[model samples]
Target: MARPPRFDTDQLLDAAVRLAAEGGPAAVTMAAVAQAVGAPSGSVYHRFSGRTTLLAEVWLRTVERFQEGYFAALTDASPPSGGAGGPGPDPARAAARAAARHVVVWSRAHRDEATLLLYGAQDFGRAEWSEEHIRRADSGNARVFASIGGLAADLGAADERGRDRVVLALIDLPLSLVRRHLRAGEPLPPHAEDLAEECTAALLR
Candidate 1:
């Protein structure tokens, strides 16, 4: 039987993430990723057809990984259904807090991937990708919007304008904070959770 290749797809993507984190999307060429992982250029091409495809895979994989945990946090921390029969404060508020903490905590935990995602994904040409890739990207975005949109409704946001405010408060604002810190090569402080939660409260209020 033939022996396995020296490097796997995940390792190449991981190297791409590092490159993206260090120098943004412009640095994530196939040669660069292969060099970072000490693999032959052919190794990268074995999995990804070219730079755009490789970048799309890298962006999609990192985002999916992050969203898995983020979505879970949102679900697990959703406010209880009824005070008479369940426990907890307002579900919307609880969900908001969970969402906020996930932004900080997840970024701190996965700094390279998080940094790459925050800075490079959209820049790496999702718009020019193949139809299937575009569909995948669109669907992923739709799922996130749907999840957060539901949360906004549950939070008593009035309509589309109100939902936009809720999303800006809970998702965009916290993510902006994380993006800034990650790009600066700084770890999010332990107090980031508290800061995010407090800010979310203020924004929603």
Candidate 2:
């Protein structure tokens, strides 16, 4: 077999992510990523069609990675049955708490990726993304929104406002906390997870 090429897609994307974290989306040009990875511009161009595609790929990759864990925390568990003794803690509440905590925990763990999230897809050139990239972004969003809706129904949310409350508790609230610290250029405090969890539990209640 032929020897493997020195740089791969992920390596370039990781470099792009770091560049984005340092500056912003505008900083992630093909040459910039190639330079960051010590790869030739040809290596970057070989994987990405152009800057638009590269931006789309990096944005989608970060989002998909985040949603993989987030969706699991939001909807992957059945309510715990009270151990042959009595009623246990509410699973809906537990999931809500977990989802909220995950925002801070994940951001702390993936600071660079989290930085990408701080900006909207538009900031990453969504308008120029290919159809496939757009679909991937939309699909991930739809799935998460559907899961949030299901959680809201479980919590007895009978109207749009109620669902909005779930959205606030599950998404907006946790993200707010993370945004505050991240924008300040500070690491999330140890209590960040607890605060997110407690705030979510309170909203759900």
The top-ranked prediction according to TM-score is 2
For candidate 2, write residues 1-205 as lDDT tens digits.
Answer: 9999999999999999999998999999999999998989999999999999999999999999999989998895553232221222677877777788788889999999998899999999999889999999999999998998888888899998998899999999999999998899999998888788778777877
Q: What's the CA error at residue 174 for candidate 1, in Å? A: 0.8
Alpha-carbon shift of residue 61 in model 1 (angstroms): 0.7
Candidate 1 per-residue C-alpha lDDT over 160-201 given as tens digits, one digit per residue, 9 for 90 to 100: 888888888878888988877776778787777667777877
